[model samples]
Target chain A: MPLPAKAFQRWLHGIAPDTSMADVCRLSQVKRTTLAQQLVRGKVAEATVVSISRAFNVSPVTSLAYFEVYRDLAGPLVPPTRQELVSQIATVDLLRAVIARTAPEEGGGGAEESTARPAESWELSPVPHATSVKNWVDAIDDGELRHRVSAATGIAPQNYSAQLTANRLAPEVAIATSRAAGVGLAGGLVATGLITEAEAGWAAGARRAALDGLSDGELTALAGDRLQTLGKALRRQEHDQEQTEKIWENLG
Target chain B: MIEILQWTTLVACAAATLSRIPNLVRKKNRSLFYIFALMTVATLLSIKAPYLAIDGMLGNTNVANLLLRFIIFGAIYFLGMRIAKGFGDVHGLQFIRGRAGTVVLGLISLALLILFALMDSEGSSVGMMDVYAKDERNRLLVEYYGAAGRAYPAYVCLAILPAMLRAAGSTLPAMLRISALLLAVGGIAITLSLLFPVIPPALGYLTFIINYTAILCFVFGLMLIWLAKAMARRKVPEHIRKPAGT
Candidate 1:
């Protein structure tokens, strides 16, 4: 995925063929010896590429996109993935969820809280839930879809769980999940926020309407599942932050 | 060749110490400044010309060599304490500054003084061990002194190695991680240097090479951390200023 030494040379020639390496180093602020060593090794370092981008009047991201691994970053308007959406939920919203779960009930056996409200603006968007990718995958799954998707994608169960926690699925894994669930092939892409529901050919308001149409029990179960995972993640994060704080206090 | 390496190492240690003078004068991180200063003096005293010159001023008895050993102990102690506290390594800190650490350091210092006193008082010489090796009884006393001088540093280095390795793998700044790695290498080199006397005479060429290389690594490692701090205080230079992007 890295731009090879030859390709980097080609790029340099394309930009300013007449310039000497010394001049390039002067402009880019890269060390001449380091650049020469990298060239000798048939690779160009990322820092060298970044410095070259500045010298050549190109954005670092645009220059970085020349590498295959960074091609996804070159797109003008790539949407945030489902994991990003889940991670971006407001603190107040998270607190509300926690409070709702533990609040005293006026009457015994009351209906779930989610069924009491209509779909809100954030929920009715083309990309629907603020919940993690894991919860969405679990909700759409029939009994064996997760296992089948994992087998097809060649991602181990633990790795799959980790990806879900991060709210991400590889594009192929997303497609495999949809295939295993017997849904539209692009459903996984839409669920992962790789593509909008509109791009996936969903009718206006259909995605929101589908979410609104789920039964109270199903909604409650999904909410419970998402909150449980989120609580564990939050606690682990808090513990780690405490340790980092101690290190900083002693050293920094 | 050994003399050349020793002088080269002294120059480098001097440079590293000199580079930190601004910080030292401002009373910032005085412990680090002291570490570099002590190490510089130790390096100076280890070299032949400076050792002979200074020993002549101090009553012509090679006590400068003993002073060099004590300075080395001070340098290693400060370096170990800094690494242990910076990494929040409780075990390393306890082993270094705790009761057991004090006892070990005291014992080593006592042993070094006793061995030096027992050796026949002689005219000044830079390489005391090499000079005393001509006489069997003085050779034994010098050998014991050398072992005593190395014992505390080896102990401190052993205690700090785990902390250094952990810091190398941690999410600290890149320069700090690299410094930790260099310190670990220096510690291992020092340990190997201690064992060099046990190796066959044919492999003796490695003695000064390993010793000097360990000194250079330690100096460069500390210098890197100092440079990183200095750079962090400065604004990005205009020449490499990143172009605004979409």
Candidate 2:
């Protein structure tokens, strides 16, 4: 399932039905003038590549690979068929179902953790305990949890723990954690080849919601498939920009 | 005054430079590590004079040189790739190879060249050796760029453009990116103030306040990351790094 270049673009384009380049530009660190020149030239040249490279904290080689992936809509190579996309969707759904079932929260096992609570905290790696950090945080409704997390992850804003306590987990915090753990989870199921950018986006959105302090319903609202996919693209753009800035800092 | 900091910085530089090579040379998908290697070298080179002489050491010039050569160039490289995707939603630029074909690359080179020229300019130079010699805290770049429009590229690259990107979207994710970018810009401003000094910067007191605050946070973050990695590698005694894990 090696992602062909076209599939990558299709997937990139596919995230959030009709994601605009303007959105990407807003998310990326590349200057508007530089972006203009590239548009006029019709291809990312050395300058763009270098800019992207510096921007993302990656080398030109990696940037070029991404360039090929993102180069226009037609895709540099054969893309997945419609059926393939559908199948990917179906697979994701199946996993979600299994996750829901095991977690005891989604469909059948609602309120399974109503009577239970961890003594302090524990990170479960192997168990399918039918509960998510979001659910746990939501149920507990405490900022101490955010403090605990901050103590663990080294992010800030004093009341993050309080927000977790207050059932007000910040969206950004959720997204960051989700990115860290969600990608790992998805990698377990779908190989990079079989997964389209859209699916990846969804997983990211889901994870962001989980970390974000939003209730499941709220997450679902924000992450309705198309919007979630778009969010993913925007997130990727943001990540790219952060990476670019880091690259520049290193250079500076 | 700077002797202790200089030596400490040099040692850290040497350690960073040496720690990265094995990973860099390894043939198996060596990118993240390679970037680190080059970055260390660049940092070391930029700060090399600090290790040797207090007086003749590269001050603000090195910082500007590194920014144009490293940071700005890297941004252009990746932006090129994304723009290559020809679509209506974006500018839909075609991808071209070679230095001559890439206008952005041309501009970056030109910027660096101009920066070097600026470095040689009368105001850009070391006009007050005595003042710096007295305290070494009086940096020049900050004094210059902090003014209305001196560090034009730095502002655009470091501050204004990122702000615009942030404005284009109002998502929480955008907020985080904007925050990080803002802090980085602040970092640049402080570093400029410290190393590549401008004669008169914008609210030196304010700049000092923000710079130190942001930098302390950055350093603390770095320390924590290092500590976490050390603990993961069992370099940190289990008893101290993670009492809970026990």
Candidate 3:
């Protein structure tokens, strides 16, 4: 869509709300140079617009229409309601729970060589799906699949998969993966329509652990809701990333 | 199983023939390396086949089996040096570095191959004409040799991986290094499994799975490399922006 005026104001106002223009830029899935050019030219791919809008929680149309968001104009929003706060706190607590299992104890020691040689010790953990996940993550990291991830997440058309697959979308790929995956976003951010299944699963697992005390009904309902939300966010992020990649491809 | 062997033979011939195509079409020495690489890969490809296990059905040893066995051992040495040089050169290798480096590498690679070959030798069909001499000691010796058979590659990788990583410019190289590391570890695990084989052989079979661990390491390592490549392309920009953002 041609960048709309209301979309622009909403986009401008979107990012400045939480953090700054710089943060918005940082959060943008597109490279900084490309984003800057998009600002200068008043043109950006739909995917970049999606990412930029999502980053600042702006309306996508406004994000495309407007050039930038400044932090000074942003204001503090109210805290979440009680129910929302409880879910978020539980999610954070879930993340913290993982630390107990992986980290070393005081004085820094782990099991030394046992009677058995530590042969292929890495695989002893035997995660059935880790192989596939690791492979996907690796492929994605290769930057050969950013747009692919976007497409898979349903953010853009499958045809758009080529932009990232061709190795064109460079710079802040971590952000692309993180944003596209919605690695750190709360359940709400996950709900925004741009998170991948793998990412959502990880979030769900972490969230589940933290909210361990929740009733079965609450947990089940929350899981379904969170999963749905995460799927949407992953799709959105993928689409945004796809758009940013297109901008780069056109420039290239 | 026979199909796999046949497929392998077809691939080997194809690879050997394909190896020549590069040298023939371009009419360049560069093709010589490609030929060697394709041939080497073909050889590596063959070493991984079990029929090339002999001494037993697809298990019976043949000329191709013996040929592949020797070729694989010999080629591992040539393959490492060649592949190392290939990767090194593409990433801007200067000299052979030194004659000493070649000698040292050749020795190490040769030793490992020889070690693996020697271990394989334990499976020899050669029986003493004087049957009385072959006793329990013979049996024990065979068992011990079998125990350490798979461990050799694991140890070799462990020894070499750090050095390889140090020489690499990118995560991909380091990851290749990790593959070597996994080979060492995986082999050791397999060896351990063989040596202390659980009585039922069920647990023992589980240990054989260690060989695949090297494959897993390579899999994950490959992922890291892709990430690094992607990151490296943008690293300069990321560096530039990090300070400003901070």
**Candidate 1 structure quality by residue, lDDT tens digits, A1-252:** 235798889878877699999999999999999999999999786558767877888765456556654454355533333323332232234334444444554222234334333542133323534443565576566678768987887889878877876678765576567567655555555556654555444555453343344445644554565556657766665654454434333322
Clashing pairs in 1: A83-A167
lDDT per residue (tens digit) for residues A214-233 in model 3: 44456455545544544664
What are the lDDT scores of the predictions, listed in order? 0.68, 0.36, 0.38
Q: What is the interface RMSD of each candidate, in Å?
A: 9.6, 13.7, 15.2
State in Å the error of residue B91, model 2: 13
Clashes of each: 1, 59, 20
Residues B176-203, candidate 2: write the lDDT tens digits.
Answer: 3344344344435544644434335554
- The lowest-lDDT stretch of 10 consecutive residues in candidate 3 chain B is B237-246
Model 1 misplacement above 4 A: A2-120, A123-252, B1-5, B231-246
Candidate 1 lDDT over residue span B152-202, tens digit each: 888988898898888787546677778779988998888776786587879
lDDT, model 1: 0.68
Q: Model 3, which residues run further than 4 Å from truth? A: A1-252, B1-69, B83-138, B144-155, B164-200, B206-208, B212-246
CAPRI-style docking class of model 3 based on DockQ: incorrect
Task: Enumerate the candidates' DockQ scores in order.
Answer: 0.08, 0.02, 0.01
Q: Scoring only the second chain, what is candidate 1's TM-score?
A: 0.89
